[model samples]
Target: MTTLQILWFILIAVLWTAYLALEGFGLGAGMLMPFLTKSDRERGAVVKAIGPHWDGNEVWLLTAGGATFAAFPEWYATMFSGMYLALFLLLVALIVRICAIEWRKKINSDQWRARWDWAQSISAWVVPILLGVAFANLVQGMQIAVVKPSDPMTAVPVDQIDLAHDVHNLVGGFWSLITPFTLLGGIVVAALFLSHGALFLNLKLAGDLGDRAAKLAAPLSLASTGLTAVWALWAQFAYGSGQPLAWVPLAIAAVLLIVSTAATVTGKIRPAFWASFAGIAGAVAFIFTNMAPDVMRSAIDPAYSLTLWDASSSYGTLKLMTIVAVILVPIVLAYTVWSYYVFRAKISVDDVHPAGLLKDKIRLGENFLATN
Candidate 1:
């Protein structure tokens, strides 16, 4: 309702968009590990391509979640508590993903690396699918109800209660979340990330490996475009807010994805990668835009929905957070940009040794430090 509340909601959406755009390809590379790489050296090239950027990419997720907790405590509490199982699985998968990536090359054993490769591949799919499902649920509306602090299921703390005092609670548990539309959403994002990752591999690897990645990217991007088209239409017609504006971002997403697929087929890998990134970003924007005044919609009853005004923290808190964000966000952006620029060289299979480190450490070129 208030300008600051709306601004924070938009900021949170932007953070989530950044997370998917940056992390999607990294995880997608992991998803491709088992299928794309015939040899450990090739897999090592894949790993090196994503290694310097993955951890930094994850920071966006952390920031998004933290912002939600701080700026929209009620929304955060209800969503996290209601969707605990799915998020728990997501967390487990993330932990497994990190371990798989960090430890896979440490032992320098083929058997060891293979096991980790499968784990990473599985985790990679789970993360994006669950995330997509969760975000889709947000847009499609959940079984939410309004409850007072006396209610056991409601997650609001008494101390945080204020102007909008009613606590919003999710009615059903995990089973309620599984739906045909939501499943399609899961598939859509998984395909999107896979396409994004393949394009990334096309950019990052050299020789036959890069060409193979490019070859795979075309089909994956094509599939992503088709899947996204189906899912976007389904969402817009069924669960969308029915506003004319909602269709704009969805339309942009579809067009960008088509451009991405075309670029891949035409051998324009850089444009293909960027178009895929922009397409995903546009899709996320549509999701947020569709929500409008409500942060969490109620399928049980319209009156029970949680709006941005109902969920937002105090004005003073928002003011302070805005100040902090202004000071820190640019620093983070600068570091991310600088890091990527410094490590911007393509990694060849020859660069990776049996241990997955650089085959030769004596190189002092700017790209040489990417191994670090």
Candidate 2:
């Protein structure tokens, strides 16, 4: 592989890591809203804790998709087409989750808020689970059939022919995406995000809410640690035997999860959260590292696997993309950091009162405008 191909692969991996780390807490917070608080004001506080950053965090998802499409069009085409149903459901869940967040506070009716709360909760849970399943499948390899086109006039050599035009078909129905290993992956990620969110709530809330969050975070983090350790070992045994280097990140992830659990038990919320973030980043890195060189592995035949070198766009396209990314990525990171700094204050039920709804709406509007 060329240096640029390897660089783009690492960049894509970084984007996915950033998405899971930042958005994990937001989705976890949303999933916890209904169960974490007894009163509407308390629930509002839970929602508000992540409200300022949820939309911004979602940009990572968009950027990751865009990056894949630009850098590895074949990988993008096969993965998206193969996993169309799953991706469609994920899109719907994301939309419902976002809409619920924005519209839940527009009125004061209990029934209305309750409906939206369910919407938000269900979608939040579904999104992460699906993402986890997708990632797990990527690691496990998919049933991909690559059919090359025949062109007599061009007389292109078989070895030199690009498979971009090959018919990359996924075998089986949507049900095939669900399996024992993939389900385990989904559970692990869901548990990790739950723990991450609980720690965030602990950090951003005060009084009874914070105490509850801390208590909840302890168990969730423990669960996450256990599940992650299991998943890592499973992945290592299942796919990492050939790539011994993958074990490094897997071991690091296991250690980070342990640290996260310990810190949570000790009531060190910030340290616990960062550890959880690092654990997730390490876990994702392990998967990509294991799958490296091959962007998409074929379950049926190793010969049909899509490699970074084979699947990537033209050199000129990648060079242009690299220039654009270098210029824009840092600016986005800086603004995101600045926004977090500005909003780095604890919240309480009092902060989400009916009287403050108007201010919240105005602030939300400004955030929307600024992000757009």
Candidate 3:
């Protein structure tokens, strides 16, 4: 692979890490609805805690996709076409979450808000699980075969695959996506998100709600750390290309989780929140680290694995993308940091219009906006 291809590959990994780190807690907030809050007002508090940044966090996902399409068209096409159902579900979950967040307040009825709240929670949970499965599939490799467009049925042996004409296709159906390892990954990811969300609540909530999330923070972080440790160790030995370098990020992620758990136990809310963020990013680091040299490994045959060289777009394309990304990415980062700084304050049940604030409720509907 050219230097540009390798650089773009690493850049894409960073984008994915940023998305998971930023969006994880928002998704976790949804997962915490049933456990952290008993009433709609409390639920509203949890939602509002993440309200300003959730949509912006989604931009990383789009940026990642665009980068892939531009820098590695073959990888993008193979992945999207192969994992259509799962990727479709990811989009559906995001859409449902957006709808639930925006429409929940329109009608101002208890039932309307309750239904949307449930939708948000369910979608939130599904998103992490699906993300886990997809990433795990990449780590473990899929049943992909290289074939010519004309003879899609017959497989081109990996040795004979013509990078110019033959295409890599995932022949296995949706059921093939499920396996013990992938299932473990799904649950572990959900656990991490739940823990991360609880940390966010601990950091951004006040009053009894904060206390409730605070109590959940330690146990959830501990449990998630344990689960991830198990999964990472297993993957390190089995699918990690037997490389010692993979262990570095896995260890860092595990240690961060431990630190997060301890920090939360000691009531260090901000540290715990940031620790959770970095921990998730570290875990993502391991996924890409272990899966490198081969972007998508072929379980059917080692030779069929798609490497950076095989999957990348032309050198010119990658160079152009790198230049554009260098220019635009910093702007996105600056905006994200600025928005977070502006919204960096705790939210409480009182900040929500109190539902009983009927005077303003009648005009604005029961929405997340505080009257100030």
Candidate 4:
């Protein structure tokens, strides 16, 4: 209700949106590495493109998580408790990805690095899926128990609480994590990332590899975008809120996806990249619009839905955080841009001289390609 609160909400939303858009590009770039880079030289370039910035880019997820915990403790508690398993999986993926990036060069044995390569690829695919699932569960609400923490003697146990039927709190399970809407979200994320990766390949790798990446990105993005369109429409019908804009972003994303794919297919790297960028921007916008006003909506009962009004932290905290963000966000963006600019050339095999973190990865990729 306060002006400060509204401003804080806007700041957090912007931060989250930017994070998804920026990181989404890297995720796409990483996934395309294997496909776009056919040789050791090209793969190195792909890795090098993302090397300096991946870690920094990932800070957005942390910022969003910490902000949510501080600003909306209640929503954080409810959603985390409900989606514990799914969140856990995402954490695992994050760890694998970080470790793979760091340890790829420590070992000389190609096989050893190959394991990390596999880990990198799997985690890359899973991160978007887990994120999509988590968001879907939040919007749809999950099966959760209403618990009061007043009368416990020592510690509250799961066994002691009444296991009641509350549809808004769904148990974060394998099936729930792979629901239709969530799967579509996952596909959208993956395809968009792959498209971004293709653009990155064009920017980072020079010759045949970049061309291969371009070829791969166009078809994959188109297929995934088509799937997303069908699922988005189905979601509107299945979880019909009768809100016209609920599914509008999906349509917009589809159009952007088509443009991006077409551009890639036609060997228009710059246009494809911009189109992919627009597609990603549209996807995030769609998500925000679909879940607007309410950070988390209920599939069962409208009364149980949690909104920005109900889930916010104290006004003082919001105001302070907003002030801090005003200074912090710009600095983050500046450094990010600087780093990318410094490393903006395509990587080549001749550049790999048996040193740095990518030595083992390059060798492994060579071996893997040779074997296949």
Give the poorly placed runs of model 4, Cα more than 4 Å off: 2-6, 38-42, 144-146, 150-177, 244-252, 356-372
* Regions of model 3 farther than 4 Å from truth: 354-372
Candidate 3: residue 328 lDDT (0-100): 94
**Of the pair 1 and 2, which is ahead by TM-score?**
1
TM, every model: 0.91, 0.91, 0.94, 0.83
Estimate every model's Cα lDDT from 0 to 1. 0.88, 0.85, 0.88, 0.66
By TM-score, how accurate is candidate 1? Answer: 0.91
- Once model 2 is optimally superposed onto the true structure by TM-score, how far is the C-alpha of residue 315 displaced, in angstroms? 0.6
Clashes of each: 0, 0, 0, 9
By the lDDT metric, which is better: model 2 or model 3?
3
Q: For model 1, name the residue pairs that clash.
A: none
Cα lDDT tens digits, model 3, 1-372, are: 678877888899999999999999899999989888989899888888888999999999999999888888888888998899999999999999999888777766777788999999999999999999999999999988888898765779766878788888887777889999999999999999998998888779989998899899888988999999888888888888877888899889888989988898898978988988999999999999899888888888878788888888887777778888889999999999999999998897999863322333465555667765
| lDDT tens digits by residue: candidate 1, 121-171 | 999999999998998898888978776767745644435544355677786
The number of the candidate with the highest TM-score is 3
